[model samples]
Target: MTAVRFKPTLLAALMAASLFQSAWAVEPFVLKDIRVEGLQRADAGTVFASLPFRVGDTYTDDKGSAGLRALFATGLFKDVRIQVDGNVVVVVVEERPVISRVEFVGTKEFDKDVLVKALKDIGIGEGQPFDRALADRAEQELKRQYLTRSLYGVEVITTITPTERNRVNVTFTVTEGEVTKIKSIRITGNQAFSESTLISQMDLTKGGWLTWYTKSDQYARAKLNADLETIKAYYLNRGYLEFKIESAQVVISPDKQDISIAISVSEGPRYVVTGVRLEGEYLGKEEEFRKLVTIEPGEAYRADAVAATTKAFTDRFAAFGYAFARVDFRPELDRAKGQAVAVLVAQPQRRVYVRRVNVAGNSRTRDEVIRREFRQFEAAWYDGQKIKLSRDRVDRLGYFKAVDIETVEVPGTADQVDLTITVEEKPTGNLMLGAGFSSAEKFTLTASVKQDNVFGTGNYLGIDLNTSKYNRTIVVSTVDPYFTDDGVSRSYDLYYRTSRPLNTQGGDYKIVTPGGAVRFGVPFTEFDTVFFGAGVEQTSIKGDTGLPVSYRLYRDTFGETSLSVPLTVGWSRDARDSLIAPTRGRYQRLNLELGVAGDTRYLRGDYQFQQFIPLSNRFTLGLNTEVGYGKGLSGKPYPVFKNFYGGGLGTVRGFEQNSLGPLDIEGSYVGGNRRVNVNAELYVPFPGAGNDRTLRLFGYMDAGNVWGEKDSMSFSDVRASVGVGISWVSPVGPLKLSYGKPFRYQDQDKIQRLQFQIGTAF
Candidate 1:
């Protein structure tokens, strides 16, 4: 493999003339054959492809240099040389060594694979050709990742080790320092508000009791910018029309363990609104536009009100097919007199229709499932209100983690737009196992396999089994939300439950109920639905051990087993912004049950009302009230098993589960025919959580009671309790934990101060 090197007589442009070294310069000649040497991993074809002059073609010194330059430019070789023989051309190359492995050390804050991925993104990873420049860049990138978590003094050192097969291994050694905290924040040029008040408006805090969980002390550029925006809004909303942030500076301590921020602002004189006047075309609906204005003549100038007015105006235009309407406003200020006039301008642009609606990111969901919830149709005039409603309806389905819709203009079209709905699907199937303990039930185990979205058809299927000392249940249920395609839903349920009221004086008597039901939900409106159902049930008193007097008497009079046919009628309406964490809205439900045929005849009805009021950005007040009543019908006594039980998580917080109402003569806690529960809660944002609504702390007050058929309903008998709790929208479900203290109690009353459950705060 010995080759003779020849000096180039002619060099290509920008290439060294002395690139090829030999005793004498060689002249160009026609090539008969070409040979390549010193290729390890690369193929010989790669060297041939880089050659400017091929074999059997007229070869020249310029071509030889150009071929060498091209091979070097390919980055596959560290060194390239051309040697000339009598009539043959020889090319030699030294290929760069490839990367064999990538490793990370001392990375406690990040996973090893995450660091590997970061390195791969920066052109430095396993199997890649090793480059010193890229290796240095990877180190800086590693440092940047650490800085995001407030590790100001973090250090990254890269070490390269040569391995076999002409490859090298890269390893990054990181030393993540202690997290830095924001020690102090100073604000200048503030006359209307105190420094503490302005600081409280920001998410970033110096520190707090929940610092570990909330992590608000961590410094981030984006978070700081958002905090600044919040401050500006606060000033603008308070009539500081000329407010501006001059400068912001962040300084780190010498030890890098603390940081300080200084902000400078200009709070000009407060301005009072003189009037709001419309100046542009109102589409002959000027009077309607005037009614939409929220600005008061004597009130302070507020940026939020102005924004709301403009958005409302734009929406009004969009309602009339003007999707591209423009609405903007400016304030004319009299600085000396602190007076301002808001002049709003509007322009209704060309009307457009939605060309098509496209859905994306629904890998496990059917297209019809999303399209069915859309109020806005394809090829329809772009209606902003309808579009917003459609998005909200899809979100309420709970099948996707996020549902986003964007309108994009169609190219080469004068009046057309496309709606792109992007969704992130979440797992709607779960096999849940739950366990609880109570004095009456002793111990209970509940297990269920439910799929809210079955096979992408938006159907629901569930199987449930429960085991408890006093009660056991086995059930199967399913629902087809679009059974008739007109937004009507159908549901079927079959269940077998064995119930036994526990008492020390009574024997272990039990009643087994086997039943099935079919229900249909008709959509009365966008937010209201009415439900109707019918079911047949057979009840058998199995144990003679020690049944309650009421149950024994009923069984004796109606025979050992009684068959009942029940009819149900219900209605529901929900206007909450979110079911998981509602900030403001109202919900109402009413249900009635009638046993019109069979051995048992009775009537039962219940009504529930809930309202959530947003007191501010950080607080919300929730009020809930429920009332129920049941009585005998057709001269038949009410069913004992149909009675309502109170004093639990869903009723009163400070009492034991199902411990309310009139007790049977056997001293067992038998439920009454009338039930009432009232609850009020004040939700407070978690300290340092930074506007996260999913997790919050709350204070609650509960008052309610149940009464037997012979007892009179009275507010004096109501039991009240006050408590503090925490609610969170966790991955598995919505969880609430509360610790309550009862303000009223009797000798026989059972008090449970602490409770935890999955579902709504109520």
Candidate 2:
């Protein structure tokens, strides 16, 4: 059979005789069978799906033209045409080359995977059809992404290489130029403040010694906008009632390596606040709402005060089940008198009930783990306070990196709402096996497997084994957070340990203690947990050559191998925003221990408190204090093994571990029965990281000491030091490194100015 090509010229000649459906010089005929050609990657089904005419149907030139247009519109083919032979129709298509791979060269600022994801979002990736237009779009998108990082001179060149099997490999070669730095920042229309002072209030700066770390010299549009907002807030807080940012202009230099920014602002006259008027329905608590007003009656107008008042009023209304409450601040101006009256109006909308509480974005975690933490229940009146509390509880669980509660209105219900809790899960455990060498421990092997959320259950399990010259240990632990329906927690610990400290110089003595414990945690309040536990242990003094005088004294008083049973009672409350890198919160712990029946009889108590205060977006203040006391029960003296040890990372800086306290005749730290410690630190954001809370720098002052049972506790006996440190919330865990300098210390004090540890800050 010979293929017949329907030429457009012949169709035009036929068009002169017939029109519309009968045009294009082709006589309509009943089609027999249709065939698709030139298909390599895409199947024949793709071509058949877009054809306008089917087999066994009357075919005309119009249907043939429409079918050709539909095939081209699919974007799967580069070319398409139709032909006829006898009563059969044929469709020919040139399929667009599929992308075999996407690669990048000379790109460093972002990972290759990030760029690949970006291109995939725009429908350009492996296995997708490729063409010139799509490649051009991908190039522009890469360039735009670089511009956000202040790389204005970045260039992207796409290279398409043909491969076998009708596919092409796309390579995006990126040439990232030098970052455009802010050469200068000029502020205009400042009447009451100097330009330098206003610039100091902003995060963006014109290059400084610290700018290399802060990257404040980099010119970013979003950063400039944020600076402008900061400047506006500065003015508004200082009584400039009509302050505004008129314009912000950013100019790039010819070389594209320097940028200049000019910000224009308008600051109006300062007005004094005359009085505050509250006009709102406060659910019969008008006086309470009035008390929330922070606007001073006679001071200069403060925009922050007015905002605080409105927010407080709104929150108070929400606490009363008014989910749609609104508070508006309307200032009554008196231009002539240079005085203004602050007026706050509140509206308590219809009280709504929570129809349902739903959790989303948690594919692995069980729903009960989150639901048990929620205080807001379904079918209850909407209380913003309860909902907020529920959100905080979930956040404190540390299972989710982000927790947000959204209030959504129920359709067709005037007074019904639903609470949606959205969460982003995080890896809650680690599996590690490694070897390390230290001067004290020599060569050691360590292995640990810890899982906080096992199989989507909110339970914790951990196993640890360490083989060190100084200390060898093996421990297995587990915790059931919800052992009972009432949120009671149960935990078990099994461990074996052997330690030999200060035994490096042919000293063979070591304290061998192996013990097991079971504990239960009972929640007394939302933020408070009371823990009680019991443990049985045997202490054996081994190797008689180099035992410390204190250890020998305890062994001589009791047998070399003595048994002890201890009971523990504890209470803790933690309200930290983040367990790894908290900027603001309060934590408290109280513990008491007593040896009920044993060769050693003693009672010990300890209390610790920590507080973190956020000074600003880039700074925080942390304070901590701890105290300990112990006494002998019955006629026995305080057990030397149970004495308090201090002067370490957890106690005082700039001193050797457990080096503070009464010294034995052997010139070793014997520890004490009483201890006190205090710490103060100022945390700052890391350079170039913006306001990231995970990495930070800090300056601290520490003071503490331990006193023996025979000595009295005195402030003069405390040792103190000042130091600077860096803290990073790394993927493995929280790490802190510090270098301290002791200002006041005894001649015998063992100084260790530098130290590093992995643990919580407080």
Compare the candidates by lDDT and give the number of the best one.
Answer: 1
**Could you give me the TM-score of model 1 versus the true structure?**
0.89
Query: How well does each candidate superpose onto the true structure, as a TM-score?
Result: 0.89, 0.88
List the lowest-lDDT window of 10 residues for candidate 2.
Answer: 12-21
Candidate 1 lDDT over 1-762, as tens digits, reads 998753222223124335553332577678999999898898898888878888789887667767767886676776676777788887877777899988888889988888788878988877777777788899899988888889999988889899888899888888898999989989998989999889888888887777777788888888999999999999999899999999999999999999999999999999999988898888999999999998888999899999999999999898888888999898898999999999999989888999999999999899999999998888899999999899999998989999999989999998999999999999999998876554435566889999999999999999999988767999999999998979999999999999877454769688899999999999988888899999999999877777788888888899889999999999988888888899999999999999988898999999999999999878999999999999999888889888888886889988887888888787777788999999999999887776778889999999898899999998778888999998988765677888999997677888889887753234
Worst 10 residues of 1 by lDDT: 6-15
Model 2 C-alpha lDDT per residue in residues 506-528, reported as the tens digit of each score:
47787788998889999998878
Model 2 segments more than 4 A misplaced: 1-31, 56-66, 83-88, 336-338, 432-447, 464-474, 499-506, 577-583, 613-620, 682-700, 721-747, 751-762
